[model samples]
Target: MARLRDLAKLIRTKNAGPFLLTLDIMFPDRRTYDRVVASGVIKKESMARFFSVDESKVRLFNYEPANAIKVTVPRLVTSGDPADTDLFGGQQFGPLVNVEVPDLPAA
Candidate 1:
């Protein structure tokens, strides 16, 4: 968790702009995931959509990815929550979360 915080701090200082961290989890484990969530390094809601998984089952904050990257801000397009599909009577998966790192901001 400290490492993640350090990484965020480093990126913030070096880039001086909004960044995106993509956490790709090949194998999902509970304990490791919980630790990340408790640390509050990344936003849970953002992560859930990033992985394209159920937010309820998978807590974004708790998730630890085998690989991650600090990139530039992305154009987020939120469709809706997965749980709302039943009510909407249509398959409405959450919006696609894409990250596009722009030029580093001036310090």
Candidate 2:
């Protein structure tokens, strides 16, 4: 939890635009998972569904509940020519890069 908060602060300081953090957990008990979800520390859209195949093992996407974090940063786009403004109107645009961190166990 503390780590997550620190990460959030770091992200804010970086001033990166349009980022996503995904946390993945493996085979966690229902109660523990629910409690973590209830914390509201993660965004709703970042929550991934969980599937339990056995009492000891469960699988979920890299999301808050799963303990995996993903950070997405937009890529910089440059115009073909400095004098040509038609392509970008004197600006450049590009898509964002998706960064996926490894999974972490429940704390």
Candidate 3:
């Protein structure tokens, strides 16, 4: 029942563009990376719910070389729009910091 933050080396968010926000979940090593990806712990459905975005619009990428997962989604509002709150998107990653990760059954 370990949390995602405890296993991830880095989980951060940033602005990909005026209309997109990007999230990065990096693992410290391959073992940890495999655990999250193989277990289906970080699926688009779950992520969509977490971010309040449409599943079809969410883009998830796993980079083996970096042992990292990247998620890109349209921002709630265009950057610098009247409704925009976080211009830098730097503080948006906090919600992912304590997400509980379910343990995969013995494989």
What tens-digit string does per-residue lDDT give for candidate 1 at 9-60?
A: 1222121122222333222344433444444434545545644454553423
| TM-score of each candidate structure, all chains considered together | 0.23, 0.23, 0.92
* Candidates' RMSD to native: 14.8, 14.2, 1.3
lDDT of 3 at 1: 80
Model 1 spans with C-alpha error above 4 angstroms: 1-28, 44-107
Better of 1 and 3 by lDDT: 3
**For model 3, how does the per-residue alpha-carbon lDDT over 1-107 read when each residue is reduced to its tens digit?**
88899999899899998988999999999988988898777889888888899999999999999999999988888889888889988788897877777776787
Full-model lDDT for every candidate = 0.32, 0.30, 0.88
- Candidate 3 wrong stretches, greater than 4 Å: none
lDDT of residue 97 for candidate 2: 14
Question: Any residue pairs clashing in model 3, and if so which?
Answer: none
Of 2 and 3, the candidate ranking higher by TM-score: 3
- At residue 102, give the lDDT of candidate 2: 29
TM-score of candidate 2 versus the correct structure, residues matched by position: 0.23
- Candidate 3, residue 17: the lDDT equals 85
The Cα error of candidate 2 at residue 84, in Å, is 29
